[model samples]
Target: MTRIASYCIAASALFLLAPSAALAQEGEATPPPAPEGQAAAAAAPAAAPAQAAPAKAEPKEDLKDKPAPNSIYAEGLGAGLWYSINYERRVIDDLGVRVGFSYISIGATVSAGNSSSSASASLLTFPITASYLGVRSGKHALEVGGGVSVTYATAQASNSFGSSASGSGVGAYGSAMVGYRLHPVDGAGFNFRVGAMALIGPGFNVFGDDPTAFGVLPFGYISLGASF
Candidate 1:
């Protein structure tokens, strides 16, 4: 009976030891599953940095191939009972050519003690000019040019001294002008300018030159005009 008890104790001990040995082997052999929270945290930090990289690279495309504003102009001028037709074409941003035709006339009459005199003068002038124009901003501009003018003038006088005089002349002149331009509206608008010009050169008489010889003369012009 004692031997039978000893054998039974040994079998119980073997069974207990077997379970401990198996548990130790399993602990050393198998790996644990990764922690879900830790893995997700690591992945989120990496993804954030990757997403932020694209935003820094996006602005380079926006700065490429940008365009500029349009800079071009066309203008004209006219004035008074003495009228002028002028055209300006811009060759560059601030330089241009001015071309124009002008017409002028004047008449006078006097009487003293039944003696009467009448006088009249008419002129047609054409100017071809090149100009340098400057506009620092919108609505204001300055212009200067030197030009050649061809003028055809006719004068007639009838006096009480029993003399009637008529004269016609053709003149070649050079002139310079400076002016300001004001624009009040948008592109489809008007511009007004005021300026003074000096004309000086020689003339030839076609008829009636005995009393007044045609030669170099100084003439001046004052003008106000608008452009549309």
Candidate 2:
């Protein structure tokens, strides 16, 4: 009877503990609830890295192969036939226009048989021309052009007897030129040229001398200046 009672008590105790062990194992397998701060952080999206601002673009420089536009030069034996100071402008690519001025004065004395006569004269010349630059290679060029030159003259004469006389006149000559030039190709610099000119005009007496012969006269010239 004692052995049977002990065996029955052991079986009852094991049956009562089995359900509690299973419930404890199930509770350990499930995760605990997160704290409030940790839950909010986990639920939100991650932050992105910061990016720098873009740099500004710079302006580009200009580089062109064209020559300068303005020039001032002195010329000898050109349209003025003596010397002249000239200003020139490039009206377009390979084309130029020029204007110049010159002045001259003369005095003479004649004596015969205790009588003397004095004479004086002055001349002003203006030249205007347009030229075309043809064949060209770095700083060297060929030029051809045509235009007209206008001249004004004044004369005065006096004798020992106090008699005086004065007169003035105007004249024009048609002129043309062909030449070679040494000029700057890009910017402001030295300029030089040599050329031949042909002049045609009517005959007249402007100075108190013989009348000028009418014809085409071939002349030569040289020039020097700065181009800008």
Which candidate should be chosen as best, given lDDT against the real structure? 2
Can you write out model 1's per-residue Cα lDDT over 186-208, one digit (the tens) per residue?
34345455565544343322344
Candidate with maximal TM-score: 2
lDDT of 1 at 193: 55
Against the reference, the lDDT scores of all candidates come to 0.59, 0.86
Tell me each candidate's TM-score. 0.45, 0.68
Give the clashing residue pairs of candidate 1, or none. Answer: none
lDDT of 1: 0.59
